[model samples]
Target: MSRSRIVIVGAGFAGYRAARTLSRRFRGAAEIVLINPNDYFLYLPLLPEVSAGVLEPRRVSVSLAGTLRGVRLVLGEVDGVDLAARKLSYVDPEGASGELRYDRLVLTVGSVNKLLPIPGVAEHAHGFRGMPEALYLRDHITRQIAMAAGGEDPAESDARCTFVVVGAGYTGTEVAAHGKLFTDSLARQHRRAGSGLRGDRLPRWMLLDIAPRVLPELDERLSRTAHRVLTKRGVEVRTGTSVKEATNEGVLLDDGEFVPTHSLIWCVGVRPDPLVEETGLPSDKGRLCVDEYLQVPGHPEVYACGDAAAVPDLTHPGKYTPMTGQHAVRQGKTVAQNVAASYGYGERRPYKHNDLGFTVDLGGLQAAANPFGVPLSGPLANAVMRAYHLAALPGNRVRVASDWLLDAVLPRQAVQLGLVRAWSVPLESSSPETAHAPAWSGHGYGPDGNAAEKPSQG
Candidate 1:
């Protein structure tokens, strides 16, 4: 008899974990097919380091085809799912379309940058969710600082020196923190190199959020620690504040302050991929609804997890799990086990795991963490953060660690390759699960000739 086919959509934390676990467990018992836009699984947490030039882009990306054994890799962006027919369709990177039939389907489609209706933000601000954005930022910042150093007008130099980051979440906070350090190094290098635009003020970084504090969702101590570290690093943390409007010239804060800047890094958050809603399935707040076992109701063969699924939180009654790395990783294993159990591999289990703790790397030896509720700061926290990342990263530990070691001993590479352009990483990327096509076309294409969603990276 022919083996059953299992199709897993996505390659982020949940999708990658599920693929790895399922590949190990099923082996020849089934055909494991992993569909992702890219052939690599991005280690998203380390993305901040990529943007800050602490780590190279490839350092955080583990090879999907290389590391995932016994899995057939399909490179494409899923555009539609026909649940009733048990078939899905997608367009490859070259505008070629294909379809696949699955005995079991797993939707770990991750998420895309959350967009707000704020005026001009869609056109002006850049998001920090993927490799393209990170790469763009690294070069953009370097070029800005370099250009500012040789600028003739002080106001233009000041504008170029100022960077406004919206949202004080982990991504935003880390960007502002590490980014401050990265620019500081560049400024020093610029001065030493001699001859250029002198008298330019130091780079000014502003981290704004509507919340009361940085990392507000984490422990109070963690929040306080991050806040203190940021303020000390000369990052202007404007809590209880937000952007009223964003323009190419600058951002207008609700507090009546106009910050002249050439850069806006949007790290507000992410919403489930729009693919979940396109299915016309029952959903909760844009995520596909799934039971504790990660199976879609009335669709036993279909499973959903990660940021794309609204999995009930057994620990908290009547509530759904928050989209976090901790929950997604666990849910991936649970989904695999439950899928296997459905085929009589083992007993099914519910998804349950409390957050082990939270760690925020504040660049250099500064960090804030409350692992298992033990609050730690300074070098100790940084050590914990680094160790956790090393262990969590699926591959390339030595390379990442070496980067860290060399960064401490050597100056960061302050050059941009001009690889990713603005058109490549538009703020309104179509779907997080889809690898970006040069030109968005085929099915799921917006009337404007792009994917209905936007392109994203990690």
Candidate 2:
């Protein structure tokens, strides 16, 4: 009999782990293929640090080929899958199309940004998902502050200096916190240079969420810690409020107040990749539905995990697992084992993992973390948070750690690398290039493409 071919689509938490585990379990027995746009797996949790100049972009990306030894790496985005034929079609970086025949398939394409119906949000609000968005934001923030420093019109200066971040999740909170400090440092530099810019008034940031508190999904204690830290850092936290509309000038809140600002960041949440809809599989809330064993309900040859799948939470009856990296990574391991079982290597088992805890980096020495449900805050939380990320990252730990060390010893290098355009990293795109594209696209380009829903990344 021919050797079984296994294809995993994605290089995020779940897909990467699946590839790693399967390669080890099967060794030379089975052929494994991993498909993704980038050559590396992104350590998404530390993306805010990248934007804040606390770390380099390379620190967050682990080389796929260098790390996954036994798996064949396919550098492209899977466009369509013929389940009956067991064939996967994807377009390469150079626009060439290729097909792969598989005995087993794993769908872990992950999630995309969730865009609300708010006006102008699609045009003006930016997201922080991948490195491209992070780099673009870093440049955009610096540009805004520099423009505000020397602008002749007071109103224009205020608008340029004002920033609004919607949502108070871990990503939103960290972005706002780190972003606040970055802007301040930029403004101070302009004043020191005597750039004829008003340095008396500092940049203003507002963090908004419809929920009553920040980190609504996290423990109440962690939320309170984050709230206190943000409030102390001069971030305007508006709970129970949301944007009714967003214009280039600013956003109109549900509370009948219009907040004027040139920057509006949308960190609302994420929905499963739209590609899941094309799979012809049963789905729940846009996520592919899977049995407890991480297999498609009717197709034992197919598996789905990560943000793309709706997996049952055995720990909480009547609930599906929340879309998070923690669960996705574990599910990847379980799916690999189950796939091996289909080849008569082992027995398949259900996917079940309890929440360990969460870490929220609030920039500087401030952080909110709960490891093993033990709440911690301040520098202690910061230490734990860094440790958690260093331990969780599959690769590039040394580089990331070095960056952190240098950040402590040296001043932040805040020069903008004008690479990512506003269109390239739109609110959402089904195209895979958007997911793996570079941060900078030549000169004078930004990621201002069509809009889609927001994404929730771990």
Candidate 3:
């Protein structure tokens, strides 16, 4: 008899952990297939470090095939799911399409950037969701500083130097905090070369959020610490504020204020991938609805977790778990165990995890973190943040550590790679294949357009 086949979608924090756990439990008893556009699992929390030039982009990506033994890795973006038929359709890297049948399907398809109806935001603002975006931001920041130094008009130079970041959540806060330091360092180098760039009056950075404080969802202590540090570093932190509109020149604030900036980094929160909408499954607040066991209701063979699934928060009674890597990692383990139990291996258990706490890296020797209920700040918090990331990442710890060591001891090497374009990394797409091309080519195309291929093997 053929081995029981289990397919997991979206090889992110949740799906990667699920595949790893199932591979260890089933060994060769079951065939585990992970379907995703990329062959690696990205450690998303450290993405800001990539954008800030503290860590290389590849440092945050762990190779799925290289790390997960006995698990089959399929490179594709799942576009369709036939629930009654128990099959999934996907498009591969080389632009081919195919399908796969599974005994159990895990819909871990993660979230994408959540965009508002703000004018020109979808067209202008680049998001910081994936590796490519990080790379693009790194290059863009370096280029902006370079261009500011060379430009003749002082007003144009100031505009090029100014960076406007929308959203002051963890991602935005981290980006703005680290981004200021990076641009300052770049300005220093330009001034040394007699490039007419002044060291004292360097580029300006503004962080905007609709909440009352930076990292509003985090502990109050962390928010206060982060806000203080950013203020000292000269970051303009505007609370209870948001972008009303975005244009080629800059962003318009809700308070009827317009800021001129060549760089507008959008770190707004994420929503479940649009693919979830195509599933025709029951949803709660734009997320696929799943039971405490991480199984889709009315379909025991179907499981969902991560940012895509609205898993019940038993601890909160009526609330759903927040979209964080911490929760997704734990939920992935639970889903794997439940799937094994369905195969008669063991009894299944519901997923329940208490908040371990949150960490916000403020770049350099500053950070705001609450680990296991302990409020930490300054260098100590930065140490804790670095240690947590090293422990959480699945692979390449040595390389990441080495990069940190170099960044601490040596100056940052600032140069634009210019590989990723603003058009490539939009404010919405997460998966690489779709992010590689324009949004219209991947989703909006009809049958007349060439369809992307499916690269799944069994």
lDDT of every predicted structure (CA atoms): 0.87, 0.86, 0.87
lDDT for model 2 comes to 0.86
**TM-score result, candidate 3:** 0.94
**Candidate 1's error at 90, in angstroms?**
0.4
- In the range 1-458, model 1's lDDT, one tens digit per residue, is 36999999998899889988888888878999999988899888888889889998889999998899999999999999998899999988887999999999999998899999998888788888778788888988988888888878888888888998999988898999999999988988898888365564568999999998888888889889899998988999999999998877888999898888888889999998999999998998899998888999999999999999999998898999989988899898899888888778889999988888989989999999888989999999999999999999999999999999999999988887767655566788865423244455543455554546533211
TM-score of each: 0.94, 0.94, 0.94
Clashes (backbone N, CA, C under 3 Å), per candidate, total 13, 23, 7
Better of 1 and 2 by TM-score: 1
lDDT of 2 at 300: 83
Give a tens-digit lDDT track for model 3, residues 161-184.
Answer: 999988999899999999999999
Winner on TM-score between 2 and 3 is 3
What residue runs in model 2 are displaced by over 4 Å at the alpha carbon? 431-458
